[model samples]
Target: MSFTNKIKKKGPVDIVKPADEVFDNVYPTRISNISYESVIESQKAVKEFEDKDRDILIKNLKSAYEEVFIKIIEGCMLSDYIDTIYNNLPEKIKEDFDESKCISQLLNSVNIYLVSSKMGGDKTSDEREIPSDTVESIVLSKKELHDNIANKKFEEANKRGKLNNAVRLGCYIRDTKRYFASEGFIQAKASSIHSFEDVSEHCSIFLWVDNIYDISKKNDNPSFEALFTFVLLHELMHLMMDVFDETKFGINGAGNLKDLGQLYGYFREESLANALALYLCDATRNDALVYSILDYFVEGQTTPYQTGLLYIEKDLLKKAVTNWMKCKKGKYLTKQLAKEWLLEVTTESPRQSELTRIEDAIATLVP
Candidate 1:
């Protein structure tokens, strides 16, 4: 039987794993052999897609989305599957896990778009450009600027020093922007609620084909399907928890209102998204694919993402997800809350050693 058939029949609890077999059946040697260079060369060759070609590509992706991800979410909502998470959650938060909200309605609301790359990495619009004329005119004869400044006749030295400062400042600004662009912002992103104001009323998820391939090449080359599904799950969670009121969080992750106007995107929110995604993978029994995907998120990623997975691994997943869904604007699982909950759990449970490690982990994050 096909994998989808297997999934529908067994639900998440009994779904099959050894992801390679299922992926091979569907994609058939299409993804495993892909390399960073190969993806780059193929994209470079295409230049731009004609209207008809773009439509066909999107059509195919939507079909695959229905066949794969839709079923994956469906299976998670099935009786034995969701019960694993729902049953463990506190009574107050149980309402969010009800059949109505857990349905595919939220899944279908997000629109997907394909792009080659997002622009921040290439250049910063605000970056200052060095003056070409000034650079060309400068001729530094002396080894040191201070030495030239000592000589009363060294007017040229002064010009060279100013030019050198401008060039250095320009380079420094350019490099800093590039680093912040790549690190602070997600390469693959889902449109925030604000996007609805200018774009269509519906939210959109952008799949940067170039960035996807590049990340895959960096990680241990998990199947493209597996990675895409994980990314979609991450983005989807963001959409679900999205709120217009930043006042709900009151303070930033750092305990200040410096970024009060912005929606909270700190450890609690990110980890909840990741922990919930990891929970789905576990409930679905997709161990083979899930472990690699987990590593993909945990390894070489920023603090919040890594810490998010750590929360899941430490067995706070069900509660963490529950709090994010039910509490005040999904901001209840703050670092302070996590520490308090961990202390409670550690005191009541026999797994003192394991809980200690989690406590140590949470200590590193801001309260």
Candidate 2:
């Protein structure tokens, strides 16, 4: 009377007949079942074999099923169906298998694959927030800013320059936050520290804007972009020093030059940090400051000598400041010794070049 009673009475009806009955339940009569019938007929063509080949066939079928299951899960298909299918897998195939672990690994792989397929990955959406206290802060469209620069609107150009600096700072802050978050560190508030003393205390950033007159009077030889690149690199060098020290030693590591002079005793580490910072800035912004710093080290000539002097009188002095900022050995280096080390590394020093190359290689491995 019914299909089930008919199949039972027939003593295991033909696989093809049962398959066709199942298909009829799946498809409406209005749509032709020709394709479904072909699939069933093809399945029927798989014949019983000897014991050895039968084992091989079973293994292949299990592998195929696993592949299909993984693909379905990756597509975000029906979760309940996935569970049911997984549960129905043969005991030997499911032995020692962890469904949760398998699903997590597959999901991670899918996320990484999708992210890598995009242009810049997640970096594109990480927009920075500009602080309200920044002078003359105004958001401008990228196209309009480019047009202003092209038309030589000097006033607008300067304003755009300030905004660009703010954006750059914001990006750095965002990156720092990500770095801390990845390391399981709680994020502190984002605010400016007005003094070096204050900066050494809290996890903070200080933005130093050179006097406008000082910047404006310079002959248009060095582009504003170039100036911004240099100053930012210099400050970032200090920031990296702080970050490394904080991560390695912790917050209590900060003190006056005399208090924690031991850390700078290793001149090689300080030089490496400075060089690495420049390399990172160049890789990210294509900044000329990278070359300028390299040239200062290699040729002993500063591109913008005035800015260099204003920031630090000499390479020796700059090295001293770096040592003061980062040295942990608790031993003080005399001003003369700092200058000697700085000159030794910057002039025809193969060691400095090797350090720079190492930094370049490390940058490629990060992000």
Candidate 3:
């Protein structure tokens, strides 16, 4: 069965929403009108609930997994799979690919933590319910702070009040920090964004257990296992470029893909990373059907996640990642040259046979 058909048969019917609905729900509108004092109290109440729920979720995860989630981590290592993928690299660059070194970097370079999410962008039906009142208060407080600066009214900054603006600002900072450690914590499935900075010593990846646990309950447990494995590999790919690729050419680094995308609008690093992870999963499992279901799950995500499937469909993933590794310096100029090379080698005129080949390519991956 095809990936889509399999998902339709076994996956949740609501898992894949129509594109318009996806966009609308992904960027939901939130408004708040609660007072600052009320916001503080609501935040406290929310935090208490969140802390209790997080503890319970963590306990359940550990208890369910026999007190260790190491299997999932071990499964993602894929040493032989990495070797196979790099074996196809050109002879000159093949020498630079060290499986042991890469694995070491993966293990030593960053700390991984499984934690609960703050539920900012949560859409799962089984998600732990944060009180609506508390949520509204948090949103309104943030909005009020934003409007004060945006409108240049500085209503909160007025010196006429008995309580000084400095005091109010400090309160705002404290409350927000208590409610959310960082905005990223609220939305990311797994994050390596901090691992990009050269000076950052405390690089970490947080796998949001709240979302994962809820999603796992909705589907069979193995599906959750595969989903977790894919997410970790994706983040690890980013970490490899950030910490292991000594050339300092981490795709998302300052002058690499991140800057390239911002300056010239060439943004395929996320897609590349996603494609690389998908390949690793397929290689590690050698089960085309399992990987296909994973692919369908990714399709339900936002555009960046879905774009990588194009590379797989076009049979360009192997070539694309190999070219990426070949160009040691991930600068715009360097990538421009690589892009030209890719186009030159893969370019072809419209032909019916080529169309048939492309369709077959996609089918083979999913079959």
Whose TM-score is greatest here?
1
What is the C-alpha lDDT profile of model 3 across 15-123, one tens digit per residue? 3232224321221110111112222222221233366654544344333232112332344444533553344333543344454443432333343333334433343
Alpha carbon lDDT of each predicted model: 0.37, 0.30, 0.35
| 1-367: candidate 2 lDDT, tens digit per residue | 3222332442122323544444311111100121233222222112223456434433433332232233333433323223533443345434544654433222221100001111221221112122221332324443443344344342453333444222122112323342221121234233323222222223322222222112322543233334333433343343433332332211122332221122112233334434433444444443353454444332322211211222222333334334433332122234333323333333332244443333333233221
Please report the TM-score between candidate 2 and the true structure. 0.26
Poorly placed runs, candidate 2 (over 4 Å): 1-201, 244-274, 285-343, 346-367
Model 3 TM-score on a 0 to 1 scale: 0.41
> Candidate 1 on 186-236: residue-level lDDT in tens?
221332233121111233344444344445556645545556556656655
Which RMSD does model 1 reach against the true structure?
16.8
Ranking by TM-score: 1, 3, 2
Q: How many residue pairs clash in each candidate?
A: 0, 8, 0
Best by lDDT: 1
RMSD of each: 16.8, 25.2, 19.0
